[model samples]
Target: MKEIVILGAGYAGLSALHVLQKSSADIHITLVDRNDYHYESTALHEVAAGTQSGEKISYPIMDVVNPKKTTFLQKTVEKINADEQSVLLTDGQSLNYDYLIVGLGFQSETFGIPGADVNALEMVDVKTAAKVYEHIEAQLKEYKTSKDEASLRIVVCGAGFTGIELVGSLVENTKHFAEIAGVKPEQIEIYNVEAADKILPMFSDKLGQYAINHFKKWGVKLMTGKMIKEVRPNEVVYQNGKDGDLESLHAKTIIWTTGVSGNKIVGESGFEERRGRVMVKPNLTDPTYDNVYILGDVAAVMDPASNRPYPTTAQIALKMGHYAGKDILNQMSGKASTPFSFKSLGSVASIGNTHALGLVGKAEMTAYPASVMKKVIADRSLLKTGGLKEVFAKGRFDFYH
Candidate 1:
């Protein structure tokens, strides 16, 4: 039997496994991951903001994987030896594969900023988000007696999708947290710092304006065109611009959602990578090694329409997984694989619990309808991954809130 090893149980890896399992061909599929549970990474921000529970964002790997055909190994990947077709696991075991799928996902990119890696709270995983939630709650509880405004000051780095969504959730939940802590809403301060001139730079001007307006109305301080110079336990230092003087913002909590790069293992494996991501061929396989496929945040594929690399999003990752599965099956069947052609499905971002912004096809949406669309997109993902049962168990059905 062919030994097919799939690494990392994120969106891409899991989707590939599901599609591959549908085939009747006899193959040994090993799904390896550091965590036994597959996490809804997109919902991690909600967990960090205390708007959702950790249990809601995660589900057991067995919930979706068919044990009869697939063997799930919970272990961390230490290295990938493409030349030998083997993967070194941290548990002192080595796994060999006839076909290898690397979807190891991402790591927080601090851009070499000092102290940012060590000090900033990242919204990368469920555990990290829970830590952030606990920290925020502890600070809120302490503020009840100490009345320290510093404890209430929150500085969120990056104004991209993840950063903005997190800021929105924090803004919406701050009122509720203050109420429970017997403090006024105005006592809380949230600063969204961005290096760009405006938030949501990749989006249309109207949508960006709408998000900016929402931040303004919600009392979220927008610090645009500010570059972070350093991060500290109690504050962050930033420069106004390229040649501007340095300034400082004191806060008890500093969230760094600035950026992400491919996991280091990809580069350490000796793949031609830029920014820790492998630039894969049109078929989503390594140019030199046809047996290895990369997807999600680890694979850098260019979009012919824009002549730029596709942004790392859950939607794109899901599509990549689907296509990668097909390609692998074709290879196994001795049929030529087709090139990957991505279709634009638009995008959505939650501004708050009840508010959101979206661009589906050519139409733009905001507020309640956008919020509903966001949840619909989320539910659709779960439905694809673990069927209707998973949707009912972990789906976001409370759209009106």
Candidate 2:
């Protein structure tokens, strides 16, 4: 049996393990992740919001790694030795592989702003979400005895889906926690700061406007067209782009969701990265080595239609994982497998409970229907990855119920 080691059991790595194991029963596989549980990263904001606990978003990685054909190792990968066909782990040990797959998730990028690293709460993974949840809970408690509500300000830096969605979710949770703590709803200021001309710059202008409208309706202060010059322990200084004005805002809480790059190990390793992602060939294998494959956030793939780098999404990551897994099987078995070409399904984001915006194919949706679909996607991910048994173990037998 051939040994194929997959690093990082994220969306891509896990999906690859599932697909390739089923694709070839003769191949032996081992999946590794730094953490023991696989986090549902798409729903991490909810976990941070106190709306959902972090446990709901994470499943044991070993339970999902098929035992018949695969092994699971909870260890952090130190470096990849492409020349030796082995990988170094943090435990002072190494594993040699006949084939390798890289699917490490994202790392927070502060864009070189001061104090950003020390102060900003990064919504990177489930653990970070738990930290955000705990921090918010602690802050709310601390504010209960305090008189200055203005000092309880929360500044969410970035207007992307993660940032916008977090603020949207955070507002309601803030309100809930505020009510519990006897604080006025209006007292908790949730400000969303964006450097771009508009929020959700990747979405259509209309969609962005809809999101902005929703934010305003939720009492979230929209600070658009502002660049973060510096992040202080007690304040966030910014250059407001309104009429070329410079302004600053003070906040006790700063959640930084500005940008993300591939995990540190990959970028610093021998892999060639164009934008914190390995440049993989059509078959989703790294250009540097035939035995090594790159998927998910670690791989930079071009959109054939536009020739631009595709935005990293879970849908693409899952598909890319399967592509790599099957292609590797094809290569090892001397069989034929098709190159990867992702078919865009659609995406939806929850603004708040029972409120969401969805773009499925050409149709656009907001409100209840979108929220329902969002639930479906979230539940389906757990079911698909861990099967109905694990889903039920999570108390999700009937998805809608």
lDDT of each: 0.89, 0.81
Best by the lDDT measure? 1
- Candidate 2 residue runs with Cα over 4 Å from true position: 393-401
lDDT of 2 by residue, 73-188 (tens): 88989999898999999998899999999998788898789889997888898888889878877776777777556456788899988888888788768667777557778778
What's the distance in Å from true for residue 160, model 1? 0.5
**What is residue 6's positional error in candidate 1, in angstroms?**
0.6
Clashing pairs in 1: none
Worst 10 residues of 1 by lDDT: 174-183
**True-vs-predicted CA distance for residue 179, candidate 2, Å:** 3.1
In candidate 1 the C-alpha lDDT for residue 203 amounts to 83
lDDT of 1 by residue, 117-204 (tens): 9888998899999999898888888888888887888889999998999999999898877876678898888999999888887688
lDDT of 1 at 335: 98
How many clashes in each structure?
0, 0
